[model samples]
Target: MSETAPAASPSAVPLIRCRGLERAYGTASARTVALAGVDLDVVKGERIAMVGPSGSGKSTLLHLIGAMDAPDKGGVVVAGRDLARFDDAAAARFRREEIGFVFQFFNLVPTLSSLDNVALPARLAGKGASEAQAAAQKLLDRVGLGNRAADFPDALSGGQQQRVAVARALVNEPQIVLADEPTGALDRRTGEEILALLGEVVRERGATLLMATHSDAAVSIATRLLSVEDGRITEDRALTPITAPIKEHA
Candidate 1:
């Protein structure tokens, strides 16, 4: 079948689009449905929160859009690149260069220093070691982790580790950032700090954010909210929205 989606007007073109998306696991008798016929379009510069109960398909939708998993019956397109057309290598390249991800677990490499962990994606995208480290250092400084660059994941506090994760996500300068429960591992105070930093940097970079979360802190910065339930999107609405960061005095 052609990967064509129903035509959208030029002005309404989305940076990410999902259509008839369906995903399931297990055999028919014991199958578990994750997403059922989800249709979503995300324009650039919007912060959207995908919220629901733990098993409500939010993460499944994230995984599909992030190229971590595939839909059973439909397709996803991001930045006009059809995810269905991506082979393993293409998907890796796409993920390395086109999108970023921050997970609940602060998935940093245990053995790599904080700087290396953040630099991994840029390096994978074919940067020289110095170039990748330079970019990583800049982001670490942005996330308030410049001093911790040489520390390994084991040496950092939970909040610090998450800061590293955030820096890592932005290292590639991706147009889209997918975060799943990004603050789940941090304490309340730390979570808020990280979320604020995240929102600030993403807004400054003009990148779109799609996060699957249950935290009010995450929702507070969102421009749109999507509530998924029992494998489908049940509600989508606009919120107060995140405006650009206020300029600071010199």
Candidate 2:
């Protein structure tokens, strides 16, 4: 959140920019402030871990970046598009075409097979059935779930379901991925596995990853750490580069 923070690279343009972002809940008299004057610049391909205590606006900021919620004050500019100017339909289109989302609970359709669940986003993005299936299959294979493509969410293990969720997020070939506590529901070892896969896929696609998490395992994959406190960024620092590749966890 500093103008003096070392730049991402020679490209001074940020893929995402949040200026004075503010969001709150409830009526003003009893309102809860979620974000207050947060300013951040995210360059392309940067992996950012947003860490904060509960109720500190970590999720609120992620929602704003992904167009899941509107900011009460200030604005967000993503890929040169001003989010405040987007209508409901436009926002939906943007999310479908440009941003991928991974959640803690997986959120796959209960009745859909793994392949179908993974292909859902691509279908919504207007890809044909065969194309969507192919993309979904590739992602599933990448996550080591290709053989389980026909299985439904309820039939899969927690780690497998999350792998499917990760595949679903990437099916559209989105440039940005927004994950909200993606491994919060998994055990420690499982969480580590999921994070490793998430990091690998994002890197493979050259996509930016913005995750809100409390887990140190989640933080390990990030190139930068952002600490949020009381609705504002309290710290932003670079992480040491990982010389060794993250081991395959599954």
Compare the candidates by TM-score and give the number of the best one: 2
Candidate 2 differs from the real structure by a C-alpha RMSD in angstroms, to one decimal, of 2.0
Residue-level lDDT tens digits of model 1 in 1-250: 4445433344878999899999999999999999889999998988998899989999999999999999999999998999999999999888888788999999999999999999999988889999999999999999888999999999999989999998999999999999999988887777877777788888889999999888887777788889999999999877886565533221
What's the residue-level lDDT of 41 in candidate 1?
A: 91
Give Cα distance to truth, residue 236, candidate 1, Å. Answer: 0.5
- Write down the worst ten-residue block by lDDT for model 1: 241-250
Estimate, for each residue in 161-232, the C-alpha lDDT of model 2 and write its tens digit: 999999999998899999999989999889988888888889889999999998998778888999999999
Work out the TM-score per prediction. Answer: 0.92, 0.96
Error of 2 at 140 (Å): 0.6
True lDDT of residue 129, candidate 1: 100
CA lDDT, candidate 1, residue 17: 88
RMSD of each: 4.8, 2.0
Mind sharing the TM-score for model 2? 0.96
The lDDT, on a scale of 0 to 1, for candidate 1 is: 0.89
